[model samples]
Target: MVQNLNPATVQGREYLAIPGPSVVPDRVLRAMHRASPNIYEGALVEMTHELIPDLKRVARTEHDVAIYIGNGHAGWEAAMANVLAAGDEVLVPSSGRFGIGWADMAEGQGIRPRVLDFGSHAPWDMARIAQTLADDKTHQIKAVLAVHVDTSSSYRNDIPALRALLDDLKHPALLMADCIASMGCDRFEMDAWGVDVAITASQKGLMVPPGLAFVFFNDKAAAARAAQPRVSRYWDWAPRVDPDFYAAFFCGTAPTHHLYGLREALDMIHDEGMTRVWDRHAQLARTIWAACERWGSSGAFQMNVPDPHQRSHAVTSLRLQAPDGARLRAWVEAHLGLTLGIGLGMSTADDPKGEGFFRFGHMGHVNGQMIMGLLGGVQTGLTALNISHGSGAIEAAARVLAGR
Candidate 1:
């Protein structure tokens, strides 16, 4: 590895700009670097009790939350297992990879998914969703699985508007939001938005490693859970949230270090204030968009989502002419120690490998200078690789960061 490495990258700490498993803060790292505590009793148990409310605060929900010892996929399954049994149906309006992945998971579990693919670049068409609900005379759809922010496409769905649509049509379908990417980065009010259930993982916006996942549910979703005849033991949320079954918090021994890391991460988020954390993410996203817009002006650099309102503050997906995206990514990582996210589910007829697409993750534990450095690295790669792009991208990004 050392023989093939660039001198600049060999010394400096590499920055990972992937959508999930974002840069973990030193505080969180320190918190996790500890001896395993007794799961039966003591500070670990007490901290577990405290995490629920803090986690709820991050999701902006005043409902019950179940902590699962798994990733975001586990959270999705956990949420589905509680309210949806085998042969049940769900309405999935997919925008990108993660959305489709959730629906696929449902299908694998014997549940049917009615997917209305809105393409990878666009947000869900409200008219189509409204029409779909109106067309459902018997209300066979048990729940509407909405991905709040698809990390693949970097598009943020309008959860509140979707709730309003369900309300206007008097749809009985429960609203379940997949907030795996948007949890602490975007502004999500579960109660105010009328979302019955929401799922997220410790990775992404929570600024923790990939281990713990959370499923939050309201009274209506709880009723739906009650309606289910039988749910898988490991995926059941009732026991996880029940105070009487403390030992069953994770269906087993518990992820000790992950919980500690999550606790520290939650503390950092609270200390920064949820509103401010969201604001910071939005501003950083704008900074990235600013630079990308400048670069796109003179080249094949195009942002996936055209509308700024629909774009996710957590991540930004971009496309360049075939092979340029891959070239630039390789250049940056090898020379500047900056790793960009690979384009996910953005393939087309011309570019079958999705080599023209790449993504920038600006969520969780990111600051203005860090974003500038990321942009600077990309700019350098663009120049080094002789990729045609508009100039002054770094300046444009800096201006946005400076509030100009």
Candidate 2:
């Protein structure tokens, strides 16, 4: 671990700018810092019931949501278990590591994954996906597992357009979306976009801690569940969404503190309104882009996705000269108390270890000043490390934030 050169400066509250498990708001922390409540029929039970509708609101859906006491991967497993069976085939359109992870999870559960890899830096090729679906004349593909936003590459796939393609081809495959990264940050309309099932976790844009996960599914997905041969009792969504007992919400014991924290987070999201929440993320992303574009003009710095339209508003993937990505991240964290995300699965023939890649997570509970501070820290790191970069990078970022 790199130690802070100035110990006195590292005494303050540290900022976490990684992709998931985003910065938890003070209100959410306060909500969870209490004695565990009664699990049977008191506030916790009623509150859990209330959380379902609010969670659906965030996804812009009026479907059933089953809560689980696990991380995002657990949500993926739960969704897969309910609607899909062993030997079933699903279409996975991969843009980055998260998408590939989901496909791997499906294969582990005895399902076959037909992955249409689009590398780690580009968005999905709509025509290619359409061709794959069109070729499956017998409809062996049960579901199209779509990742709404891949934080590893900071690319946002076009969900609505994919839905349109499926419609045009008259395919019978269910459209399941993995919105673990884009639920509250990006504009996701599960029902409006004709998504059959959607899964997400409490971490990321929900502004809560890791642990709690949710899987929202419509009637079509529920019918698929009914047709399944058998599902694990733990992964079953039937009892979870419509439970006879309160304990069925999360199988047995409840996630006491996480529930309290999630309730508070949902209140904050609704209070701000989804429109402003998305707008804030969009503006912050543009601010980061402005600075990165300036830096890339003169150095080895470059944004992973060339088209801004294909990028995610929650996180930005970048590349510097080999070894510079690692050096700059160390410099900022040690000296300025700011941490950035490591490049995940961005390896190439030249940079096999992905030493030249990094990411900036401008997700939940972030604002203008926080983003400005983040960019300023990076600017300082580049200068201190003697990396060749353009001037006025910070100025470019500030101009975006200032709307100049």
Candidate 3:
């Protein structure tokens, strides 16, 4: 028999504050409740036809977009498939677990990866990266991969600056970005930022389940793709963007439910307006950080991000008092029915120095009340555990949200 896995729901209100599989909008969830569609039918075909342009608008690129029935990792594979051949050289800047995973994927594909790591929190040294590109006289780097936001650390790197660096040095490397965290939550301009290829998943800012992955590419990347001698058919962007509805949207039978979910998601994004959505997220995130700062100054807590602007508007990492992080998180989950995010790439958790860190996700359907509820739960947990913390964190967050 299956075990009772989760704690009982919080008296009809359980909070899923984990970074991904973000709170789904009721409309989107309802959209997925219907039966599957005939892949070749009129509505499905017409819906498929309308999807690409909308998806492109979200990515801020008029270039090609491909959808796959997979997660963000598949998006990475597809982007790489279009651009890399066996033994091709690529430069990878890893700031966290996700970045390292991308480099490893490239390696598995027989692409030679030259890595420059910037830890889990900060962005790469721009001058150093520019010099590296300038120093590569042979132009051995076929592509340069960077993560726009490292979800694990809630770090948002400057993609525009990376593009500027490439332009300054006249680097021929095709620039790629993993915008999984920053896509809808954080402001990302693919064409404007000179991102030749970009990838993302559905679970984060897309407000959906973990079934869809999107890859966006530009003319330069397409041209480079044409030059690839060993592009995988399944991952090839050109084959997928066949100008026909069926081939363009799905190579095999469509992920009908996910398509429905995506359609609703897209509608919600466009209706709310992407710009306004991003601004709302930014406002909410600032409130969270403000609470963290107020708590940190009490000599009991601190935010993991060194700079406020660099911290992702989608997620925030908080370092709590000594050796109580894991315990406190467990207590919160058990008692309040709230799920907190783990520090994916951090070293010291529940340590003697009390460097335990946790992350809070404020992406997609999250809002002022959701954030307040989350912070309120954290405050409750801290008090119940008798953990030293400054009071009024929730109030600070409320004021931040209220524009006080």
Global lDDT of each candidate: 0.91, 0.92, 0.84
- What TM-score does each of the candidates earn? 0.98, 0.98, 0.95
Name model 3 segments beyond 4 Å from true.
1-9, 243-248, 349-355
The 10-residue segment of model 1 with minimum total lDDT is: 1-10
Candidate 2 on 151-192: residue-level lDDT in tens? Answer: 889999999999999999999899999999998999899999
Which of 1 and 2 is the better model by lDDT? 2
> Candidate 1, residues 155-263: lDDT per residue as tens digits?
8999999999999989999999999999999999999999999999988999999988899999999999998899898988888899575589988888999999999
Clashing residue pairs for model 2? none
Model 1 vs. true fold: TM: 0.98
Top-down lDDT ranking: 2, 1, 3
Prediction 2 TM-score vs. true? 0.98
| Number of the top lDDT candidate | 2
